[model samples]
Structure formats: structure tokens, C-alpha cells
Target: MELINNLGLGFTTVLTFQNLTYSFFGVLLGTLIGVLPGLGPLVAIAVLLPFTFALDPVSSMIMLAGIFYGAQYGGSTTAILINLPGEASSIVTTLDGHEMAKQGHAGKALATAAIASFFAGCVATVIIGLFAPPLAKLAFQFGPAEYFSLMVCGLIVSVVLASGSLVKAFGMMVLGLLLGIIGTDSQTGLQRFTFGIPELADGLSVAAIAMGLFGLGEIIRNLESVKSGSMQVSKVTSLMPTRQDLKDIFQPMVRGTMLGSFLGVLPGGGALLASFAAYALEKKISATPEQFGKGAIAGVAAPEAANNAGAQTSFIPMLTLGIPSNPVMALMISALVIQGIEPGPAVISEHPELFWGIIASMWVGNLMLLVLNLPLVGLWVKLVSIPYKFLFPIVIIFACIGVYSMGNSAVAVATMAGFGVFGYILKKLECEAAPMILGFILGPMMEGHMQRALLIARGDVFTFFREPISAALLILAAVALGLVLLPSFQKTRSTALVDED
Candidate 1:
């Protein structure tokens, strides 16, 4: 009864004439961005955030969140129609989705992706409705000690799951932490890391960093190996899946949704991890493993479901625990902060409308995606034909204009340009920027919690271990750290053996 009432409240809020309009535009624009290669939701949301300042918080968030998941849907179109993946989460989809397109099943593959995504999105919304209350109840259980410990564990999980060398991941995380501290000291009111720059006092702009690294950096990279012309798209037949296609995908979709929902709720394991993990699990469990990647419908079905489910459920930690699981969630939290609404457990009680409205908007957004993807399949294919020469300038202009709009400051442009160059360097080094951004996002919160916990403990070093919940979390972190290091140890030993031989 309570759940139904919450849903009612959400719909009442979302069904407002203003919100419905923005929500539709959000998904429509998200789909357009997702069909383009190298343009992810992270860039899309960051680029468009400035325009939403005039609207109410709920409406703005509704639109941005739509873009986030809408990208997940649009990315599938590119993956199916062309061999290239528009988003990293859709890379696995291209392995089989593109193959299915080659086998003259392009329409069927696209239809399957849309349907599976819708099913997963609906299931994920239910999971949110059921699990969020219980999880938010945790606010009462966590003191500074517990919160600090949890953040530590979250950071470790980030390093463990990040792609590339362990040393490099840790290095990036440390760099992010350093960058996070570049602003004025919150407690002491002292200016640190300003280096005599006045803008540094307010700290680095999130908009600047996000646009520089993801938006401008992407355009720069895409320009280097520029394509002379647009590539051909596969011919899409009837956009209806047959009886066999549905039968094959039903079980896989369920499994993917379940897996994605669980991972997406974790502080560090988000949609990227969920999608990859789901694909790996499906390939491992399929009856005919040999057919797994050779145009298997299940391949397209599972990962698409997983990525969409993961994208929806990734909101869980951000809403309930006040911890962002990924950069996209971090941006959402920033949006809430800008509205003077602190993210965390009390959000449900204090701002029930915002909480439930966002949740309900997800389902509406998913429905919109289903309607958009099927009939507009032809449109997305045409978009794929848009030349990079044309798209790159628009993206570059958007990045510059969006970053400059923040506080009407020119410093944001300089900051974005620096980070754009830095992002390119990281790409050259094969080091990921995701973990670095995660560290940047979580650093201040973790530091604040640690400071408070230590103050409460009167400088006792063992206070973290003395608290039961904190102790268990620290233990878990230690074990995870050990596991992360074990592979490196084994590799080093093997190398030594080879040298001796």
C-alpha cells in the first residue's frame, strides 16, 4: 500500500505538463548522442547541465537521468547498425549485435535490444522501490566511523575493478585525491593548492573537469584518426522478433537483470562492470558456447539487459547511501547539492517526491525508449551516416560553450583545456580516467568522515577497529586489497622464474 502511494506521488509529480516535456526531450537528445561513436552519456549530461539551471531541481534531474539511461538504449542502435560501439557498455553488444546485423537480422537484433532493455528497466525500477527503503534505513546505523570505513572500502573496490595495471589505477586514484584537495580547506578556511590563482580558491569546477576529460578529450581523440567519410549501415529488415528470438532471450534477460541489479547497487561496481560481468557469465553458461559470439541472440539480449538494468539501479547508492557509484551518479549528486538538497538516507523522508519522482521517471523514460527505438530505427541508421567532420565541430563547440557557461567564467575553459590534454595523455598511457574521477568524487566526503570520526574518538587510532561495523568493513577492505595484490605477486614471481630460466 505504501509503495503504491509512493508511486502515485511520483506519477503526480512527473505527469506535470512541464516535466513530461523535458523528459521526452532528454531521452530524444540522449538517443541522438548515443548513436554517435565516442560520445558517452557522461559527456552528454555534463554538456547539457548548464541549460537546466532555470528549471526546478526535480525536472532538471529527470531530464539528465533520462539522458543517462537513454544513452544505454541509443548505444545499442549503433552497436547493431554499425560494428562500432557508441558507448563502452555497448562494446560487447557489438560483438554479436553487429554479427546478427550482418546475417540479415538487423531489425530483429534492434527489436530484441529495445524489448530486453525495457524489461530490464522495469524490473530494476521495482527493485529500487523494494530495496531503497531498507537501504535508507541504514542512515541510522552508520556513524562517522562506519561511514568513513565504507568510503575506504568503496575506494578499494574502485581500484580492484578498474582496467589496466594495479599500479596505474592506484596512481590515478592518488592523483585524483590530490586534485580533490586543491580547493580551499573546508574546516580551517585556509587556502591550499591555490598557487596564487584566485579561481583555485573556489576549487576546480566539476563542469570543467568533466567536459575537459570526457567531452573535449573525446573530440580531440576522434579527430586524430579522422574518418574521411561516413560508413555504410546494415540494411534493417522487419523490426519484429520472431517467436524463437523471444524464447531464447527471455531467460537470459531475467538472469542479466538479476545480475545487473545486484552489481549496480554496489558503491564501485556499476553499469560498466555489470555489463561486462553479465556478458562473461552468459558466455560461460550457454549450452552451445561455440555459438556464443557468432550472431547469438542471447549475446545481444544479455548485455543490453544488464547495462540498462545497471544504469537504472546505479541510482540506488547515490539516492540512499549518498555515495556515487560512478561519475554519472556523482554528477547527479552534484545536481542535488546545487539545489541545497543533501543526498543520503534522510532524502526519502525529507524529499519523498524527489526520490520517488526520479524513480518513476525512469520507467517513463524506458517506455519512451521503446517507442523511440523501434519506429525510429531508420532515423538512427541515418544518423550513423553523419560524417565525423560535421559532428566534431559541433561537439567541440558544445564543450567550449557549456564549460564557459558555468558561473560565466573563463577559467572553466582553461581548466577544461588542461584536463583535455591530460586526458589525452592518460589515453596514451593506457591508464583509465574513471577511477581517477571516482576518487575525485569521493575524496572530500571520505576525508570529512574520517576527520569527524577521529575527532569523536579523541584521536584514538584504533577507534575504527573498536567499532563493530567499522571493524568488519575494514576487514573486508583488507581482504579485498590482498586479493587485488595477489595477481601482481603471482605475475612477478612467474617473471622472475622466466628470467632465471
Candidate 2:
């Protein structure tokens, strides 16, 4: 009953003209970015982040969430048509999706991907409605020690989730924590790393750093790769799937949806992880596993559904506990902070409209993708052919104008430029930025809670273990780190090297 009422509030809030319009535009842009061969939602969202400053918190979050999930839907288009996975989560789809295209079942493959994604999205949204409130209530019970322990667990969990070397991921996280402490100390009012600049008093601008790293750094990286953007598509017979095709896909979709929803709430488990896990599970369970790499319908349907479901449920942690489950979630939290709203368990009770509105917008965005992506397939493919030379310059110009617009200061823009170079260097070093960004966002909060917890315990560090919740979280962190140190785990990491970034 409470869930229905909250959703009723959500639908009412999102049905407004302004909110609906922005949501539509956000998904549209997301689809466009997803269709491009090398472009992903992370880069696109980073570019669009600066523009969201003009929007209300509810609308900005709704739009950014739309972009992230919308990219998951759009990525399947290229994977089926041109053998390219625009988003990392879509990588599994290319295994059989492209084969389906080659076999002249392009329309069927695309339709299955779309319909499964929609179904999974509906399921995932309902899961959020049912589960988020209880989790938020649980989070409300956490004390300073518990919060600090959870933060430690979050950081540790990121290293596990990261695709690259665990050592490199941890190094990046430490760098992020250090960067997070650069501003004036909130409690002491003393400067830490301002280097005699008044603008540094508020710390580095989130917009500048995000735009520089994701927006500018991505452009530089893509330019180095330099590939022709033209796409080749198989002939489309019809968008409708046959009864047999639908039957073959239904169970896989259901399985993937359930699996993804469960994994998405876990720290560091997200769309990419869900997609890969679902694909592996489907292959393992299939009677004729040999058909998976061929044009099997289940191969196309399961991962698509899992990734979409994962994308929706990944919001659970960010919205409920104020801890980000992924870099994209971290970015969403940044949006809330810019709006003068501190995101945490209190958000559910204090700002019900903003909370529920974003949730309701998820279903709306999925419906829009189903309607827009089908007929617009040809249009998206054509748009992808536009040269990178034209795109990156516009992106650079947008970054400059947007960063400068943050405070109307040349200093802010320069900070972005510095981070752009730094981000490029990190990319060259094969270090993932996701952990770093997550660490940066969580670092300050962790320090505050840790200090408060210590002060309250009268400098007795054993107090963390005395608190059950904190003790469990810290134990989990220790176990995770311990597992990473094992020789077997190191060998597994070496053999299964995946790149989320």
C-alpha cells in the first residue's frame, strides 16, 4: 500500500510537462551516444553534467539516470547491426547478436533485445519500489562507526569490482582520497592544499574534474584510436518476433532479470558485471551450449535484460545509503549535492517527491526507448558516421564553456584543463578512474565519520568491533582484501582481465 502511494506520487510528479520533456531529451541524447562505435554513457553523461546545473535536482537526476540506462538499450543496436558494442555491458550481446545479424535475423535480434530490456526494466523498477524503503530504514539506524565501516567496505569492494589489476585500482582510490582532501577543512576552517588560492577554499569543483576526466580525456583517448565511424547494417525483415522466438527468450529474460536485480544492489556489482555473469550463467545452463556463440535467441536476450535490470537496481545503494555502487551512481550523487540536497536515508522521508520522481522516470524512459529506438534505427546508424574531428572539438568547446560557467572564473576552467592532462595520463597508465571517483566522493564523509566515531569512543579503536554492524562491515572488508591477496585470486584476475572503462 505504501509502495503504491509512493509510485502514485512519482507518476504525478514526473507527469508534469517540464519533467517529461527533459526526460525525453535525456534518453534521446543517450541513444545517440550509445549508437556511436566508441562512445559510452560515461563520456556522454560527463559531457552533459555541466549542462544539468540549470535543471532542478529532480529533473537533473531523472535525466542523468535516463542517459545511463538508455545507453544500455541503445548499445544493443550497434551490437546487432554493426558488430560493435557501444557500451561495455553490451559486449556479451555482440557474441550472438552480430551472428543473428549475419544470418538475416537482424530485426528479430533487435526486437528481442528491446522487449527483454523493457520487461526487465519494469521488474527492476518494481523491485526498487518494494525494497528501497526498508533498506533506507535500516540505513537510518547506522551510527558514525557503522557509516565509517561501510565506507571502508565500499572502497574495498570497488577494488574487487574493478576490471584491471587490484593493485592499480587501490592506487587510484588512494589518489582520489588525497584529491578529496584538498579544500579548506570544514571543521577547522584551515586550508589544506589551496596553494594560496582563494578559489581553492571551496575545494576543487566537481563539474570541472568530471568534465575534464570523462569528457576531455575520453576525446583524447578516442582521437588516438582514430577509426572510421561508418556502419554496415544487415537487411531488416520485420521488427516483430515469431511466437517460437518469444518462447525461447522468455525464460532467459526472467532468469537474467532476477539474477541482475539481486547483484545490482551489492557494492561494486553493476550493469557490466551483471551482463557478463548472466551471459556466463546462460551458457553454463543451456542444453546445447555450442549454440550460444552462434545465433541463439537466448544469447541475445539474457544479457540485454540483465544489464538493463542491473542499471535500474544499481540506484538502490546510491538513493538509499548515499553510497555509490558505480562511477555513474557517483556522478548522480554529485548532481544531488550540487542541488543543495544532501543525499542519505533522510532523502526518502524528507524529499519524497524527488526520490519517487526519479524512480517513476525510469519506467517512462524505458517505454520511450522502445518507441523511439525501433523506427529510428536507420537514423542512429547514419548519425554515427559523422567524423570524430567534428565531435571532439565541439566537446572540448563545450567543456571549456561549461567549466568557465561554473563560477565565471578562468581558474575553474584551468583546473579542468589540468585534470584533463592528468586523466589522460591515468588512462595511459591503464588505471581505471571509476574507483578513484568513487573514493573521492566517499573520502570526506569517511574521514568525518571516522573522527566522530573515534572521538565518541574516547580514542579506543576497539569500539568499532564492539558495534556489531560496524564490526561485520569491517570484517567483510578484511575478508575481501584477504581474498584478493590469495594466489588463486591473483591468477584468476590475470586470466580474466576485463576492462570496464
Candidate 3:
């Protein structure tokens, strides 16, 4: 009954004219970014973060959440039409989505992606509404020791989630932790890694690292492939799916939504993990497993559905606990704080309108995406024909402008250039950048919580194990790390490795 009342209030807040307009605009902008091959929602949000300062807390959150989930809709369009996924979460869609396109069912594949994504988004949002409050109540019990142990576990699982070379991932994580140590120490009021540079005193900008690592890195990588000849874009047919197509996809979509919603709330694995897990699960359970790699409708539907569910549910940690289960959610948390709205268990009680409004906006945004995506498929398909020479230059210019606008600093531009070079080399050396980005986001929080925990524990490390939540998190992290090291896990791991090569 209370949930019902809260949802009614949420609807009232979201139904306001101003919030509705922002939600629409967010979905529109998100679609544009998702359709553009080199760009993703992370870059889009980072680039636009500074501009959102004028918005009220609820409105700003609504807009950002719209873009986050809306991108899931547009991501599959490119994945199906061009065999290129704009976001990491969309990569699994390319496996069967592109294959379906090759079979002259591009429209049907796209339709499934859209409908499944919408359903998953709505269901996941409801789950969040129900679970977030209770979860946040539990989080209120966490002392600094619990928070510290949880962060350690998150970092370890993040490293294990890396697609290749555990050593390199660990190395990158340590480097990120070291970089996180820069600026003045909160406890002793002394500078640690500033090296006497004025900019270093304030600490490295999140905008700088994110834009460089994701935006610039993508540009450089694509530039290297510019001369390697053009890609094969699948031809578009009818824009609507047949009745048989709908029947075939409905069950997988439901399964995916359930699985993704469940997995997304977990600390370490979010959309990226959910999408992959959904794909594997679908293949295992399917009566026609042999059809999975060969244009299976279930193959396309399941992961597409899962990715959006996971994307939506990831907000659970961010909104309720003031912790981000994923890097993208971390970015969202940064945006929330920039608006002076501190997210935690109390956020729901203190700002019911904001919490529920964001939830309501998600459902509204998903509907908007479904209506927007199908009609625009032809326009996006045409984009696939753009020449690499023209595209690569524009990508470089966008990266530079995005980095510049985010911080208003020339040093940030320089930092981007350095990261660009480093990222390129990392790619060349067969190291994955995904885990590095995750590590960079998690490292600071990990350190802050650890120091706080030590202070509260009087330097006794045993306190974490005394708490059930922290203990469970530590054990899960251990199991994940152990699985990565085991010989059997490596075989499955190798096959699922993102063939960035």
C-alpha cells in the first residue's frame, strides 16, 4: 500500500510539463550519441555535465537517467544495422542482431530490441522502487569498516570482470589507485602526489580522465583502422516484425528482464555482466542452441532486454546507498552531487518527489525511445555509409571540445593527449581499458572508505568480518577472484573475450 502511494506521488511529479520536456530531450540526445559509432552515453554525459548545472535536482536526474536508458535503445540499432556497438553493454547484441540483419530481418531484429528494452526498463524500474528503500535501510547500518570492506570487494570483482590479462588489469587498477592518491589528504591536511603543480593540488578532473580514456581512446583506435577498408552495413527491409517474430522473442525477453534485473543490483556486475550472462543463459536453455550463432531471434532478444534491465537497476546502488555499482552509475552519482542532492537512504524519505520522479521518468523515457527508435532506423542506417576519413576527424574534434568544455582547463587537454597515447599503447599491448576505467572510478572511494574504516576501527582490520554485509561482500569478492584464477574458468573466459583485435 505504501509502495502504491509512493508510486502515485512519483507519477504526479513526473507528469509535470517541465520534467516531461527534459525527459524527451534527453532521449533524443541520447539516441544521437548512441547511433554515432565512436560515442557512448558516458562521453555524452561527461561532455554535457557542466551544462546541466542550471537544472533542478529532480529535473537533472530525470534528464541524465533518460539518456542512460535511452542509449540502450539506440545502441542496438547500430549493433543490428552496422555490426558495431556504441556501448560495451550493447556488444552482445552484435552477436545475433547483426546475423538477423544478414537474414533480411533487420527490422524485426531492431523491433525486438526496442520492445524488449522498453519492457525490461519498466519492470526493472518497478523492482528498484520496491527494493531500493529496504536496501538503503540495510546500508544505514554500515560503519566505515563495512564500507571499506565492501569497496575492497567491489575493486577485486571489477578486476576479475576484465576481459583479458588479469596482471595487466591489476596493474592498471594500482595505477588508478595511485592517481587517486593525488591532491591534499583529508586527514593530515598535507599534499601527497601534487608534485607542486597547482592543478595537481585540486586533484585530477573526472571529466579529463573519462573524456580521454573513452572519448579520445575511441577516436585514436578508430583512426588506426581507417585505412583498413570499409565495414559491411546490413541492409534494412520492412520496419515491422511479423507475428511469428513476436511469438519467438517474447519468452526470451521476459527471461532476460528477470535475470538482468537481478544481476544488475549486485555490486560488481552491472549491464555489461548482465548482457553476457543473459546471452550464455539463453544459449544453455534454448531447445535450439545450435541456432544461437546463426540469426536466432532469442539470441538477439535476450541480451538486448538484459542490457536495459541491468542499466536501469544499476541505479539502485547509486540512488539509495550513495554507492555506484558501475562506473557509469558513479558518473551519475557525481552529477547528482553536483546538484547538491546527497543520495542515501534518507534521500527517499527527504526527497520522495526526486526519487519517485526519476523512477517515473524512466518509464516515460522508455516509451519515448520505442516511439523514437523505429522510425529513425533508416536515418541511422544511412550513417553507416559515412567515409572513415570524414568521421575520424570529426571524432577527434568532438573529443577535444568535450574535454575542454567539461573543465575549462588547457591542462586537461594535455592530460587527454597523454591518456590518448597511453590508451593507444595499452590497446596495442593487448590490455583491456574497460577495467582500467572501472578501477579509476572505484579507487578513490576505496581509499576514502578504508581510511575512515581504520579511524573508526582504531586500526583493527577485523571489524569488517564482524559485520554480515561486509563479510558476505568479502567472500563474494574472494570467490570471483578465485574463479578467474582457476583453469576451468579460463576456458569459458577466453571464448567470451571481447575480440577487440
Candidate 4:
């Protein structure tokens, strides 16, 4: 009864004219962004974060959430039509999806992707409604020690799950932690790494760093790799799936959704991991695995469902426990901080309207995406044909403007430029930036919690182990780190990550 009431209130909040309009605008822009290659939701959100200051928190959140999942819907369009994945999660879709396009079943493949995504999204929303409250309730029992241990577990899990060299990931995370502490010390008000720069007083801007690392960095990288020739887009003869196509896809979609929902709740597990895992599962279970990369409808359906489901369910940790499951969730936490709302157990009780409104808006946005994606398939196909040369400049311009607007200072823009160059160098070195961003976001909070916990325990070093919850989290972190060091697990990790190459 309470759940129903909360959902009702959420709908009431989201149904407002301003909220609905922004919701539409968000999904629309997200679809457009996804249709364009080399621009993901991270870049889009980072570039737009400064502009959200004018809107109310609820409207801003709704818009941002829409952009996050809406990209999933649009990404498959390009993957099927032009053999290019608009989002990283859609990379698996390019396998069988492009194969289907070449086989002249592009419309069928697109229809399967759209239908699976919609169904998975709706189910994931319900899962969030049911599971998030209990998780948030559990979070209320945690103290500073438990929070600190949980962060340790999260960082370890991120390291274990990151698709790169373990040493590089760990190094990046440590660097991020170092960067996170650059601002004035809260206790003594002494500058740590400012070097007498006035702009460093507030620490590095999250917007600047995010835009530089993801937006401009990606733009620069894409420029180097841009092909000179035009792409040949597949034609959509029809948009409806046959009855057999539906039958072939139903079971894979269900399995993918279930697997994706569970994985999505884990730290560092999001759409990219979910989609890859789902595709592998489907291939493993199929009687004729050879059909996987050769235009199998199941191949198209499973990964599409998983990525969309994972995208939505990844919000659970972020919303309930204030733990980010991925870099995008890190950005969402930044948004919450900007809104003066702390993300944790109290978010539901203190701001039920904002919490539920974001959830309700997702359902509304999914429906909007379903309507928008199918009829506009041709439009999206045309969008994929746009050259990177034309698209990147606009993104660079917006990213600079957004960073500049944050402080109206050239230093912020310069900071972004420096990070952009740094980001490109990191990319060239094969170091993943996601874990670094996650560490930067979590480091300060982890430090604060650890300090508070020790203060409460009177400098007792074993307080973390003395608390049962904290002990369990630390043990989990230790076990995950241990597993990563094992040779067998290293081989498995290499196999899983090789798909990205």
C-alpha cells in the first residue's frame, strides 16, 4: 500500500507541465546524442551540468536520468545500421545486429532491440521500486565505520571489475584519491596542493574535470581516428518483427534482464559489463552457438535487453546507499550534491517527491523512447552518417562554455584543457579513466567517514573489524582483491576483457 502511494505521488510530481516538458526534451536530446558517434551520456551530461543550475532539482534529475537510459535506446540504432556503436554498452550489439543489417533484416533487428529494451526498462523500474527501499532501510543501520568499509569494498570491486591492467587501474585510483584531497583541509583550513592558486581553493571543479576527461578527451581521440570516407547506412524496409522473431527473442530477453538486474547492482557493473555478460551467457546456452555472430535474433535481443536493464538498475546503489556503481552514477552523485541533497537512506524520507519522481519519470521516459525510436529510425540512420569532423567541434565548444560558466573564470577552462590533454595521454596509454573518476568521487567521502569513525572509537584501529557490518565489508573487499591476484582469475579476467579490444 505504501509503495503504491509513493508511486502515485511520484507520478503526480512528474506529471507537472515543466517536469514533463523537460523529460521529453531530455530523452529527445539523449537520442540525438546517441545517434552521433563518439558522444555518450557522460559527455552529454558533463557538458550540460552547468546549465542545470537554473532548473529545480527534480526537473534537472528527471532530465538527466532520461538522457542516461535514452542513450541505450538510440545506441542500438547505429550499431544495427552502420556497424558503429554509439555507446560503449552497445558494442555487443554490433556483432549480430550489424550482421542482421547486412542480411537485409535490419528492420527486424531494430524492432527486436526496441521491444527488448522497452520491456527490460519497464521491469527494471519495478525492480527498483521494490528493492531500493529495503536497501535504503539497511543503510540506516550503518555508522561511519561501516560506511568507510563499504567504500573500501566498492573501490576494490571497481578495481577487480575494471577491464584493463590491474596495476594501471590501481594506480589511476590512487592518483584520483590524491587529486581529490587537493582542496583546503576542513580541520585546519590549510591548503594541501593549491600551490597558491586562487582557483584551487575550492579544489578542482568536477564539471571541468569530467568535461575534460570525457567530453573533450573523447573528442580529441575521435579526431585522430576519424575515417575520411562516408559510411554506408542500412535501409529499414519495415519496422515490425514477425511472430517467429518474437518467439526467438522472448526467452533470451528475460534471461538477460534477470542477469543484468543483478549485475547492475554491483559496484563498477553497469550497461557495458551487463551487455557483454549477457551476450556471452546467451551464446554459451544456445544449442547452436555458431549463429551468435551471424544474424541471430537472440543475439540482438539479449544484449539489448541487458544493457537497458543494467542502465536503469545501476541507480539502486547510487540512490539508496550513496555508492556509485559506475562513473555515470558518480556524476549523478555530483548532481545531488549540487542540489544540496545528500544521497543516502534519508533521501527517500526527506525528498520522497524527488526520489519517486525520478523513478516515475523513467517509466514515462521509456515509453517516450519507445515511441520516439521506432518511427524515427530513419532519422537516426541519417544522423549516423554525419561525419565526426562536423560533430566534434560543437561538442568541444559546448564543453568549454559549460566549464567556463561554472566559475566564469578562464582558469576553469584551462583546467579542463589540461585534463583533456591528460585524458588523451591516458587513452593512448590504455589506462581506463572510469575507475579514476570513481576514486576521485569516493575518496573524500571515504576519508571523512574514516576520520569520523576513528574519532568515535577514540583512535581504536580495530573499530572497523569490531563492527559486524564493517567487518563483513572489509572481508569482502579483501576476498575480491585476493581473487584478482590469483593466476586462474587473471586468465578469466583477460578472457572477459579481450572483447573490448
Q: Model 1, poorest ten-residue lDDT window?
A: 492-501
TM-scores for all predictions: 0.96, 0.95, 0.93, 0.98
Ranking by lDDT: 4, 2, 1, 3
For each of the candidates, give the backbone clash count. Answer: 0, 0, 0, 0
The TM-score of candidate 2 is 0.95
lDDT of 3 by residue, 1-501 (tens): 999999899889989999999999999888877777777888778777777888898888889888888787778888898888877788889889999899888988888899899889989988999899898888888877677777777778777876677888888778877777788777788898777877777677766777677777777887777545577777777878889888998999999999999878765567778888899999999998999878999988899889899989989988887777766786788788788878677789889999999998998898889898898887876775677678766766766776677667787788877887887778788786656665666677777787887787798788778778888888988898898999888877777774322
Clashing pairs in 4: none
Error of 3 at 289 (Å): 1.9
What value does the lDDT take at residue 399 in candidate 1? 79
lDDT of 1 by residue, 118-194 (tens): 99999999999999989999766999999989888888888877766778888988888888898888778888889
- TM-score ranking of the models: 4, 1, 2, 3
- Clashing residue pairs, candidate 2? none
Candidate maximizing TM-score: 4
Q: Candidate 4's residue-wise lDDT over 1-501, tens digit each?
A: 999999999999999999999999999988888778788998889888889988899999999999999998889999999998988899999999999999999999999999999999999999999999999999999999999999999989988888889999999889889999988876578888999898898888877887788878888888888887788888788888889889999999999999888888888888988999999999999999999899999998999999999999999999999988888888888888888999999999999999999999999999999989989988887777777777888888998888898788898999889999999999999998888888888888998899899999999989999999999999999999999999999998888778556
Model 4: residues with Cα > 4 Å off, grouped in runs: none
lDDT of 2: 0.86
lDDT of 3 at 43: 76
* Candidate 3 off by > 4 Å: 227-235, 391-402, 405-407, 498-501
